[model samples]
Target: MAATIDELIALVEQNRDAVVGDLFPVREAAPRLIEASVYHPVICLILQGSKETTSHAGSVRLGRGDMLVVSHDTPVTARITGVPYLALILPIDLERVRTLEQSLTSADAGQAASVLQATVAGSAILETLARLLAIRPKTPEDSVLTPLLLTELHFHLLRSPAGAMLRRLVSPSSHESRIARVAALIRRDYARVHRLADLAREAGMGQSAFHHHFKAVTGTTPLQFQKDIRLSEALRLLEQGAVSVTEAGLSVGYESPAQFSRDFSRRFGRPPRRVLQGIAAE
Candidate 1:
């Protein structure tokens, strides 16, 4: 089997923006700034170069041989700082994790901290990843192999040093899981009006506790979380030329054009009109 980093670098070199099997993405790019956006639960392993993620929780820099586990949907700014940055992104399957949580003993309940964190991955995790990367599917039967390997991959993550934190993240009754459910709700319904009270109820917590745990889990208030999702969607729509500035804003729950413009400008560091103009010029 090819070395883990070597295989990942080859994949990225072949298709820098390729999404391999909807489970992970191979990104190869030059150093650049990435705008703030809501990142879903995922594990990022940097194979080459480095990057930084900045959120309300703080800034964290990760490089080769390091792993980052993001437990919830969080809005943050990221920057790639390598000549040709290559990273592997594995989206966490919460349902699968929840199922696995049943097998974990009380000893697995480790301290929990939300946000992107740097941790060392064990050899078992690396070996499993290497085996996963080496797979070459040439038949229908081979297709099933990938899912099995993915399940194995998740298993390794559940037993790694960060496993306890991950366990807390997926446990149905944990505060982190409650907050994550609320975040998922915001992501799914960002274009609709959401009240803090309603969201707190959904999380099975009182308003004050919900607010505290929401911020603790996501590093942002419930309202800001919704706003981030909306603005992120609006930016995406504008970038794709799918809608006019006003349409984009209004489509993402913005009723007042003026308020949308101001918020868009503040978040993206540029107004929608100007961003559109630049895109057109390109």
Candidate 2:
């Protein structure tokens, strides 16, 4: 296993551009904190060092061979724990998962419910990841090989121990799947006005049920989810030096600058101005 990961690390270093597009390599030579963001569904394979990730659901520490499978959109803060951290981040396509779900046999259909977002990766997953990293993208072979490998990877994930989480989120009738739909809407139209009643209807649940289930699945309320999304965007803009504090707030759907500032300070432990000042100093 160590030998395989060593080879993978070399491949990742060589193919740092990830021409395949969906496969992304993350490497950090020093420990650092990753700012909060709304994380979408993805699989993160930790190949070296460790990281501690905190979300509303709580925190989990992942080391080598740990696979973090996030099934829903979540607000997350992460710190790379060990030196020379290296990992692969594969963003899952729910559309493809849905298509794959249609092919599951009856024996494979009885996946148990799981609320966990992280798990120890199996040998099969590691081997598959190594194969994925071996592909050289943008070549004729890549054109034919990437798709097949991705399908194989996703299929392996669907049958892995964490498969339950993925299955529940993709199952059409599951509450988690319903809430995911509403969450997707919020993510897309975050800058627009939204009503809880409408969101509930969209999820096909009563207001109270929707509220409960939404929180259960996402670890945050719908309104708060929107707020997090708004603040995350504002932070990004501020970091880019693209907008002033007030403009950053307004651009992300905050009508009141003071409210935006307060929210930003509360979530990020600093005002938007600090981010601007830091960017300018750079």
Candidate 3:
């Protein structure tokens, strides 16, 4: 296991600034002070050193041998706690999860949060991940084999102790899944004004029930969730220098420049210009 980890680390270091296949680069020199946008569901395994994640739901610190499961798109503040942090990021395969859901009995279903932290990972899971890292997909057959390996990895996770939370994510009838659908809608059209009633209708729930269940699953109300997504996109625009601050605000559905600035400052701990300035300096 130690040797496999070492091999994985070496592969990550060699591609420190680039993603190798589906693996996100794992290089950070300092603890990031600003929240980075996490726009999808993924499983992150800490292979070396440690890191921390803070969202509205709560905060979690993950060290070597720990894994984190994020079940939706959410804004999270993350920073490395140990120098030279190394981690493996795997995107969740919704199709594979849905397939696994069909085989789950009623007894396998349970309510679980969108975010989970686990100290243990199955050895088989780790070995399979290592194999994925080692394989170079240069041919069509290799590419075909990659998804199969990823499916196998998902199967291992579904049977692990952490499977319950994952099961809830894929169960079409589960409240968590319903909330996920709404969250996806919010992400897809965050720039548009969303009516609570309409969103509730789409989720097949009453307004009050949708409000309660959305908050329970996501740790924030629908409006707050939309605002977060909007601000995150606006921040990205500002960083990219693609638009002026006013334009960025307007593009993301904020009509009032003053209101946008206030919300942006409150969320990011600085005004938009200053944040952009800092990024430029970096």
User: Which candidate number would show the highest TM-score if scored against the true structure?
Assistant: 2
lDDT of 3 by residue, 1-282 (tens): 533566667766654544434756565667655564754878888888888888777788888777787777777778788866778888887778888765666535543445544556668787877767666546564577777878888887776666666778776777788888988999999999999999999899999999999888778899999998898889888988768889999999999999999999999888988867777798
| Ten-residue stretch with the least lDDT total in model 2 | 106-115
The digit string of per-residue lDDT tens for model 1 on 105-168 reads: 6535656555676676667677766655555544553487777777777887877765655677
Give model 2's TM-score versus the native structure.
0.92
Identify the leading candidate in terms of lDDT. Answer: 2
- Show how many residue pairs clash in every candidate, following the order shown: 0, 0, 0
Q: Report, for every candidate in turn, its global Cα lDDT versus the true structure.
A: 0.76, 0.82, 0.77
Error of 1 at 53 (Å): 1.6
Error at 238, model 1, angstroms: 1.6
lDDT of 2 at 142: 80
| Candidate 1 ranges with C-alpha deviation above 4 Å | 1-4, 7-25, 106-108, 138-141
Candidate 2: segments with Cα more than 4 A from true spot: 1-3, 102-116
Candidate 2, 11-99: lDDT as tens digits? 88888758464988888999998885778888888989999988766788999878888777776788998978889999988877887
